[model samples]
Target: MAKSDKKPGTRRDILNRLKSNGCSDATTLAEVLGVTPMAIRQHLYDLQSEGLVEARAEPRPVGRPAKLWYLTEAADRYFPDAHAELAVSLIDTIRSSLGENALQALVLERSRHQTVLYRNAMEDAPDLRRKLEALAEIRSREGYMAGVEETAEGLVFVENHCPICAAAKACTGLCAMELQVFADALGPGYDVSRTDHILAGARRCAYHVTERETVDG
Candidate 1:
């Protein structure tokens, strides 16, 4: 058989490569997956019917028109939600196997693990204000409109917007939890206050961190 006529890789391989490339059209995908154009088209159609892919018309010259295929943004829902699902399942299993107290301890342990990860990612600097500024810049690069300010209260890292979670308000709670994690990482006796009014008009809402005064002083 001719080299070009060789059988192609599995459907999963085709789907993975397409996703990795930010969703390419059928012809491009066929080249990547080592498949015939017709086979790619058939798989694309199947994926579309399953709500895993979307197709858009591409403007072309006088020849036959072409449609670009892309993995739907909702495609992440198929695999991405599994981590959260597993977390909940593990908690439930622990509760069933042990008890509520054991489950609570497990939750606390997991919280500490998450806190450590955030802390390691944003370690403390000699200058707290500078540290906050650096962290804000990092957040901005990650798609949040973020900044730091030395307010009357203390060093504040304000997040003006969150691009990713804006569309899903229910997930905003995770953002709030992240702020608390930042505060905890900053250390004991440090106050981290979030202001709802800072980004009142924003689509998802915004947050500000303020250092609290210590009573010992």
Candidate 2:
């Protein structure tokens, strides 16, 4: 039997594309999704009416301008956030009741646990790519929207979204410890360093992984 053609709802797919790749125009979106431009525009109109998307005009080299569509802040409701409000509240309570040192201890403990879990998950993998893929799968299951990609620079681990954004903002130490956790989790010969940080006002978090002759971690 021939394979059936099926796909996600157009609106959801559009939102997801915008979330992953940032702003885009309907023509570009249609091409990527194998749909007609008119269909994409219709969905964009509905999304805009629902306050989930918006568009701004950009100058074109030979034409008037192009309408570039992008997700609005309100669209964040569609993505997983790992109970942001509750996480932030817990972070606040821990800091207020126990103090800074206690919070630091808590963050460190969390990092240690994460490192152990990641290391164990990647232990059976045969190579660096396999290990990174294992790590990506684990993180994706944890709501990070993570994946591993090969680029000109090196192997890159990309987290398109941070589900614990609120909690991380409440305690920056969580962010700091994450770097150490990654370095330790990947083991001795690999060096994992973050090149992009969402907390630092970037769209997402990305880490560069490179094999070194010797690594301190």
**lDDT scores for all predictions?**
0.60, 0.88
- Estimate TM-scores for all models: 0.41, 0.88
- Candidate 1 Cα outliers beyond 4 Å, as residue runs: 1-9, 60-65, 73-77, 83-112, 118-169, 176-217
lDDT of 1 by residue, 77-154 (tens): 433332455555665686689987776565456557767865665675666676677667676676555667665665
Error of 2 at 25 (Å): 2.4
State model 2's lDDT: 0.88
186 Cα displacement, candidate 2 (Å): 0.6
For model 1, name the residue pairs that clash.
none
Task: Please state the error at residue 128 of candidate 2 in Å.
Answer: 1.8
Q: Model 1 residue 39 lDDT?
A: 78
